[model samples]
Target: MAEARRMPSETAPAGLRERKKEETRRLLREGAARLFAERGFEGTTVADIAACANVSVRTFFRYFDSKEALLLPDGIKVFAHVEDALAGRPADEEPLDAVCNALLAAAEPFAASTLTALGHPLEDIENVVTGRLVQAFSAFEERLTVLVRRRLPADTPDADLRAAVIAGAALSTVRAVLRTRRARRASGMTETGPAPLPRAFEILREIGSAGRP
Candidate 1:
């Protein structure tokens, strides 16, 4: 019997390798967050992350080229998930409601964890989160403005501008809420609180409706 020769590039093995790579990436992220929180992000190095994940420095490099990438997490995935949530909303639903639901749903992971389970101490975490939110929302506001303009009727002037203003307001509201929540926690309020995203949107909607001509 003649034996079949295998090709140089076998897809099944490649797919399995990719899956393992993804697993390593996630483990490294978790390990990095924990380490960064414990020792401070500035103090942590690639070697520390690798050691925490039980992987070699070379393997860590394969997953993330630098330490900053670990802290940022997956922006593309987060945005895509949020976009999908917005898309799922009923066509007649108010724009604010749609956006609010999407953001809150996307934030479920943070909501599920205890305040301290986020790994970083209050001040450090606030800096990291606030910096990232500012960057992300700055870009997201532009995209959302375009989306809102396109989705709404053509007769609407300044749709894009209005959308951008709403998005900025939403981001500000969320940031303020998070700051308040952190302060409340610090003051010995141990209650597991609801995410402020939805509440922020509610306020935005109220204000928008009131200000309407």
Candidate 2:
């Protein structure tokens, strides 16, 4: 996060320059997040992201190797592992169940928040833009849709739509879980549940009985 130049007399010109750099970096990240949301990840290019940020293409490269890089360090690799995990699921498993299990199986890489893993303290997560946070859930939902489609019969009517809905629901609990963790952190409370990722799925199961008699 950038240090704000709150008062004109409080900082030197050099400090103000540093603040400008921080602002540019932040703008670039936020721009990438918006672009990712507007266009699918693979569909968005570095130039598009740079233009969205109002920065030069070269400056975009200076900050990140690719647009997806804004989502996380080694984000490409993390997504690949998730795709591979999904591919190896049991053929007979339910699509939603398979995706949740696959994410759990590959959960180690996601054990830490992207910003925290990048060395930012928990509270300094202001740079973790909200749209960027949505990227993980969007990315996983996209992966689930593609992989779940493969698992369904070719003749399955509206297979793509079905996969997408399942994908959306598949991570609905994850969104809930992330909110819970954030609220706990903000309140200076500690988690007493089982391990965090598994605990999220436990929530999925608990709520799975939503309308049962």
Candidate 3:
């Protein structure tokens, strides 16, 4: 009989391999962003991005489906952070406040970076990039709904509808802030910095309170 194969120990090199893979993905993402910004999205090719990152074309495919995916990393990170924040909120916190605070916490680091990624002044971003970003945020709405539902009683009437409404309002508030901030910067009315996330949450709180009996 053939000898049984020995299983790899938990202390094997898996962690190192995973770290290297993540590093490669980061390089590809950063390289693509720089190239796309310098040469316009349509003008930049997968091969060009791979060359910029010092990786093979196959490696790029292993990391992202297309160049469009590079614009999405920050958005994906934001939603993940929001999910974690909501999961950790105090049980007694009001539902809308929980959602608002969660999103505000998640957005703090990315606020300025997000605007920079889209292009400073924001108006310079290509239509294709904007469309892709909208698609990403739409997917995030579904995730937000899941988080909001967690804050409500399991058997609450109209729980899903409530969650949906809250999620929609939260996302709409963020989008409005982005547009307003960008316009302000473009018009030379304000210096670029973190988006008014606290103010957005305050507005959300007021809206929620006003809607109640």
lDDT of each: 0.66, 0.68, 0.72
- Specify the poorest-scoring 10-residue window by lDDT in model 3: 1-10
Of models 1 and 3, which has the larger TM-score? 3
Strongest candidate by TM-score:
3
Model 1 whole-model lDDT (C-alpha atoms)? 0.66
Give residue 60's lDDT in candidate 2 (0 to 100). 84
| Poorest 10 consecutive residues by lDDT, candidate 2 | 122-131
Q: Per-residue alpha-carbon lDDT of model 3 for 1-213, expressed as tens digits?
A: 123333344435787789999999878877877876687777889999999989999989888887776765556775777788888999989788888777777654454454476464233443344445445556799889988888899898999999999888887776666666656656778554544868877877887679688
TM-scores of all predicted structures: 0.67, 0.56, 0.69
> Could you tell me how far off, in angstroms, the CA of residue 150 lies in candidate 2 after the best superposition?
1.4
Give lDDT tens digits, candidate 1, residues 110-142: 433422454545455545554554455555666
- The parts of candidate 3 lying over 4 Å away from their true place are 1-4, 9-20, 30-45, 56-58, 71-76, 111-135, 191-195, 211-213
- Model 2 residue 64 lDDT? 76
- Give lDDT tens digits, candidate 2, residues 1-213: 134545555667779889988888888877765655556455678888788888899988877775645756454666677788888988999777888888777644553554443353334242233334445666667766787898888898999998887777766766665666667777889878497768777677678668899
